[model samples]
Structure formats: structure tokens, C-alpha cells
Target: MTDLNTLLQSPIRWMSQATDPDMRHFLRDLQANILKGHGRHFTGNIFVSFEGMGAQAVARLLRDLSGYVTSALQQLCTARSSAGPGFDGGPVRCLLLGAGAYRALGNLATMPGDAAFQAGMRARQVALADPPAEEWGEGAWRPGNPAPDAMILLANSSFEAVTRDLEAAEGWLNGSGARVLGVERGRAQFRTFRPGGPAEGVEHFGYVDGRSQPLFLAEDLKREAAAYAEEPAPAGADTGFDPAFPPSQFILADPNARTELGAGSYFVFRKLEQRVRAFKRREEALAEALGLTGTKAARAGAMAVGRFEDGTPVVLSDNATEAAPPNNFSYANDPEGMRCPFQAHIRKTNPRGESTPKLPPEAPAERSHIMARRGIPFGDGVRDFEADAGQEPEGEVGLLFMAYMASIEGQFEFTQQVWANNPRFLRGLAPGEVPTGIDPVIGQGGDEAARTQLWPAGEGKPMVPFSFADFVRMQGGEYFFAPSRSFLREVGL
Candidate 1:
């Protein structure tokens, strides 16, 4: 196994743009240089559970697992070394332990700092903070299920690489410490509505997914600024960012941290099953009701998703062909939600300027309530939503939703509960305006009848209403902590 402490303490000669241009020029003159790895696309996921395992056995498992940790530095080097067209940066792996697993070790008393990990993923506090019962489907989530003991994440440039890693992991874990209770493999699929239409890469809904993500930075000052930037600036514009901060939010400091545990991140794992057929039929029905047809019928879907199937934000331009950066648009200009309905999936989750009015005047700059989402699709690639609209789904398929954060309650949970699931979110509406509905895509409606969503046709048009059947069903999930390299070693030792 890799020496966790030594790995953590090793000098990482990372290079980047210098804060002082003069100092950078001096370094260039002296032939000094530095480089760092950008992030990698781990397109595969495998979640494992170790149940009924003893403390000693769990420790041994972690020791073995340490051998699989892939550092960011390695990723950079791999990318640099690639020479051929098919050459790749190789796979990266991560190991995370769930709250139940930690409690089973009987070490919460020794490591009181891991209170959040001990709380488990489905704890009442976590559930309440992330979408209440009224927002979830009937008995879909929060069914008093036991959480997983651990999760194994493997990311590679290709599916074959991931499969090979999965096989190796299964070999490594065979009776190593904990017996495997379950294994969920995550894979990515691509398809387009037309030949060469809207890059083949799309979620089951036929819209480009995972387009908007928070920036990842390493500095405290940058993170502080980003946390404030989640809400719009005073002039109702993006708080123009300083070049100092990386355009990412992964830099948030984790509170109640134990240094010995190394730099760790909290993870929220969910197995979501998408009802593609149901969603398509509903969209078609809604489009027909709204008198939307042909290319314009696409608007009905865009109103719900806040973007067309081609990833163009309707708030920015009506034509999906007008390719633009999807994340560049904000909600400030469309306060009345004429361009983007307040209930649109993108609008509800990250309201941007819309969040400012909801903040208490005395509160700290409203933190963006950000989470670094890293999830991939799972199940067989099914694109029958268009052809098999009225029929039952051919097979199971959907997103294996996963997110990394410093605080489950603050980031991931808040986005889900306070934003996505909140019907009354994006405050400061006129007295007579109706309250915004739940996110049409992922928002759970307690009962079938309550699943209504609002879809605006265009400016000066009445908000069109469409009821949704639970299209995305939550199967199971858990909360886990991915400890730093050193922390894993300490636990094993």
C-alpha cells in the first residue's frame, strides 16, 4: 500500500500564473517554471457497500484501498505524456466511507471532529435541509433505509478502462475486509435527436446536461469571494470577479476538520431512475396544449429545462442554433421570469440574481450554496423516449447523482431543499404573482396531483401549467467522506 503520510507530505511542485507579473518575468529569465494538473473527466462510477464488517477488518480494507488513490499531479503528468491520437491520461480512483461505516468502527468518540460523517446521509437533519418529504415522491426517498458502508469511484477516459479497473477492484476486495453487498456501475451514453444533431452527448431528456458547474480553486480568499458571488452584485449584475479567484467553488473550507484526517470532502450519492417515456409524453402533451409545433414545440421543453435540447439557454436567445456559453446568462434581467420561468430546472437550482432578494438584509453575503457535482449516467443507453413515448420504459436508465462538498447541509442539501424543491423560492415576487412551482425535471411532488409545473411560452404570455408524474424516482443513496491520503493511512494503521 502507498504510504499515505509520505504522499501527503511530498512537495508538489505546482506552477501557475504568478500574482506579480514582475516576479513571473524574473522567474522566466532565470529559467524557473511550474505546472499543475487541471481536473479530469472520470466518466465511470462504481459504488460498493461493506456491511457487517468488524472495525479491524474495515481498517484493513482502507489500507488496501489506499493503493488505489490517484493524485491530481499524476493526472497532469499522464496528460502531458500522451503522444498519439488515442493516447489518454489514464484512470483516477477515489475511496469514500459512509457515516454508518464510521459509526461501526466505534471511533466517533475518538474522532469527534467527524460529526457530519457520523450523522449519516439519510439523517433527519440532512433530509430536512435537502428537499422535505413533500418534495419527494410517495415512499420514493427517506424510506428508513440503511446507508452504504463505502463507495469506490473509478474514472477513466473510456468505458473499457473503467471496466478493467472495476474488475481489478473486485479482485482486490474479495474477502479483503468487508464483504461486498452491492456494486453500482456508472457509465455515460450519447445520442442526438437528429443525425449530427446537438452533440451526441446528452442526458436521457435529450438536453445537454452537466453544462453548468462551479469553479474549483485552492485559495481561501478566492473561495470567500465566490461564496458571496452566488448572489448577484448590487447593480443586479454578476459581481465582476477578480482574476485572483479560480472560476470554481471547490475551494470552500470544510469546518470542524481534523488535520490528521487530511484534506477530505463530503459526498452525497443517489441512485436516480429516470422515467424517460413519461417525461417525453408529458412534454409532447404540453407542447400540443400550448399550440407549440415543429421547431417551436421544442420551446415547451426549453421552458421546463431553461434551455433547448442543444444547450442554448432560452433566457439568452430563442434559437438553439445561436450557440452561446450556457452559464453566462443570469436571472437579474428576467426578474418577472418572462424569459426563464422561475420554476425552470436551471432557474430554481441556481437562481443567481434571483437569490439576492431572498437573503436577509443582515446576513453575510449570500453564499451560492454550491456543490461540485460529479455524476455520470447509468444503465443501458435508452433513446426510445421519442419513438416509444406511450409505452412503458424498456429498461432502467438514469443519472447516478453524486456531489462533493465541504458541508452536506450547506451546499448539496441546501441546493436541493431550499432551491430545487422549494415552490416558494426566488422571493420578492409581486403580491398577485403566483408562487413558482417545483423544478420540472428533478423536483419530487408528494402526490401525483401536486406535481404541477409552470412553463412560460414567451414574453407577455400567460404562464402555462403542466402536471408531471414522478419521472425521476430516487431508488437509494447515502452520505460519505473521502478522506485525504494521510487520513486513510492513519485509520488503517
Candidate 2:
């Protein structure tokens, strides 16, 4: 088993990983914003294709990247020395290789067993039922941008540090003459930041984001237990389920039992463009239709998102801020989907204590479904839906969604396919009842009719049949592997 110290510093292990040198290597985003309590200060993603690069050139480039890549120990020491007391911010960067990129360099027998990872992003669009060209922006979906072979990420606490790190990476990639690696750049490149300029925790949709994430690592679980002890629980909230996921749950074993890369995780990247104006407009309409006005109108949005904008889960709070958000809860008590709709975004994606009929009874529990979501919101601040009512906005915007998992097919893809996109998810039918709707926020129901959810109307009210306009569009994305430090030093180098 890989030592917890050797793992990455993802959201699941943020508490414990920060102190351990090996684990810190994985905490790519910690240096970005202090107020948000976690995540990168800013993240820059540069996608590249290796169309004509030969094996020798590709190998050389990987070696150069091995040298350029920042280690977590370096980040920790650098942060301590430069940031003064209590600040752990530093210019941190990571490099990942897509399957296309790996094939471009030279096919590897060490690649993961997951078919989804072996097949490129274009293949995934069809398998995942993502929207086709007509539904997506120009050059956004499949076949528009060529599948990228590699992605470089630069993260920092301040905009200047972010710029500095990106410049360094850009300079390395664009090295002149002998240093060049026969690189061919791709179109999908963007940086991420907190919406509304450096103020942390708010997503483009005005929701306090990143709540209810899973806890891993000993320290993370300990901290949560401490917080839960101090805080008042929502009536009947289950706080006893252990959040500590053993390494076997999320880490990949060395496929060859001798390779460094085997210790790494597969990364799933998707650029989801949120239709803010359209979503907000729908919320207003739904609110009015539900006889809710002003603040109550927000409940309509909450019903769709399964959480109030404040990051509180609907199952726990009537309003977004009724009680502070709680991390632990299960669907055992709310089987009928009364408090939280069966197809609500969070419920569909994680389904705590809820049995999924499509999945086997012996299948891993909800803990296995957890993702180390390192995603950051990109694009301009929240769109002025009211002001820009009819006209289109200037540039692209939404989440630069990225998740690190041992199995793309098992965790991230499973959540998307079996849970989120399936309208029949969490089924418990009574004669002639309508099926649950797809996840309104991220679920890509190809047809308009497939994009509907049965909204749980408050106590005694009849369940409202709510239809959803596809609000999130899949821009381009590819799967990549962030190799371990050992892998870089040995095979990648």
C-alpha cells in the first residue's frame, strides 16, 4: 500500500496532506486562496496536441517536464519561507498527460484498465450522451478541438504569481531550437479564479460552492469530527458514518508492480459552460409558478440544485442559510425523496445511503463515489441575466471541472452516466408515477423531454412536474494521468 504521505494534497486530504511532504505534492490548489479554506489560488490549463512529434522528441519533452514539475515538498518549504506566518501560499504547478498524449509519445502498457481512459474524450461524448454540435458553442464539443495530448496546470495565490507560473511553463513549452519538443498546441486553454475577483467560495452562479465534499486522510476526518461536535446538527442528521476512505478505495496500485506511474491517479477534465442567464430566468419563472416571491423564489432554484445558493443541502435546510451546511447525511430516512429530490444534483451525484438498483448490491458504498474535485470556476463573473437578457455575453464562462480518481469509469464517469444523466435514477415506483428527472445542473439529457425532474413540493403539496432546459453545456475535455513523483523520476524522465 502507498503511504498516505506519498499521496496528493487533494480536497479529501487537504488537512493531512499539507503537513506531509509526499502528500503535499498532490495539493495543487492549496496556495491560491486562503479565505476559501481550500483550492488553488488560480489555475491555468493549457492543452496541447502532439500531432507529428516522434517518440524521441516526446520522450525529451517528458524529461524536461519532469524537471519543471513542482514537488509538494518544494511548495511547502517555499510557502513557509516566502509567505510569512500562517500562510501556505506558493506558486504551484502540475503536468498531466492525456491518453492521446501518451499515444503521441509512445503507447504505454502501463495505462489504466479503464476503457473510458483508454478511449479519448471524443469517444466519451457519445458514451456519456453529451450534447452534440447544435447544442454546444462554436468549436466547443466533439471534433471541434482536436483531442489534446497533454495539459499543464499553473496555480498560485495571487494573479501575479499565477501569471509568473504560467509564464514559466509557457517559456518551458515554447523553448527555442534544441530545447523544443516538437509540440503542437491545441485550442482548449483557460485559467480559473474565484468569481467576483479573488473573493473566495462563490461560483459564477452566485452559490457558495464546494460544500459537502468527502473527507479523507486522518487529519481531515479528525477535523470534521471536531467541527461536528461543536456545531448543532439538523434534526435527525446522521453524523456517525466514518469519512476516512482507506487508500485502497481511491488509489491505483502499480499496474506493473514496478512502475512509478502506477502510483498515480487518472484525471478527468471537462469544461462545463453554465448557462447563467437561462438558469436564473428559469428560476424566476419556476418561483412565480410555484407561488413563491422574492426570497422564496430562491427556493425554486434550491429545488433544482438540491441546495440553497448558500451551499446548504435542501435535505438539511429549508432555506440555504437556515443552518450551517453539514457534511454527513444519508438517504435512508428520506427514501421517498421528500426532503431532497431523488434526482437533485448532489443526491444524484453522491447518493449517500441511497441504494441504486442499476448498480449491484455488493458494489462499493457511497464513499467509493467520492471524487477529489479540484475544479475551479472560470470565465467572467456572474452574468447579469436581467441586464443581458437577450444578447449573448462576450467571452466563454463556467467551470473548468477536473476530478482526480483512481478509475474514471468507476467514479467520475459512473456518477455522470448511471446517476446524474439517468432520469430513472433512484427509482421507487408506485403505479403510474412519473420517473425522476435528470440532474438539472450538470446532467446532459440529450432530448428536451428527457431533461425533467419531479420536484418535491413542500409538505402536503402535490409533486410538481418540473422540466429543465439544459443549462450546462460540455465544452471540450480529455482524460489525463498526473504521474507520481517517483514515476517522473523513473519512467517519465
Q: What would the TM-scores of all predictions be?
A: 0.77, 0.81
> For model 1, what is the C-alpha lDDT against the true structure?
0.59
Q: Model 2: per-residue lDDT, tens digit, 1-493?
A: 3343344333344445556644444343222211022344466776666667676677667666666676544654465466564665665567777776566555432655668888966677766887653454433233445566777777766666666766666676666112222221111222123244333365556566666655554555677779877766556755434555654445554342233223556778787777776777888877776777876777888777777766666776667554456656665557688877777777878776565444567887666877767777776444443355555342366777777777788788888987888777777354675678788888875466567666766679887776865878786677887665555544533
lDDT of 1 by residue, 208-245 (tens): 77655554333333544555557333244443322221
Q: Name model 1 segments beyond 4 Å from true.
A: 1-50, 108-117, 125-146, 191-200, 217-261, 322-326, 362-367, 382-395, 427-430, 447-450, 458-461
lDDT of 2: 0.62
The residue ranges of model 2 lying beyond 4 angstroms of the native Cα positions read 1-38, 75-88, 107-109, 133-145, 175-200, 238-242, 254-262, 356-359, 381-395, 428-433
lDDT of 1 at 422: 69
lDDT of 2 at 201: 65
| Every candidate's CA RMSD | 7.8, 5.7
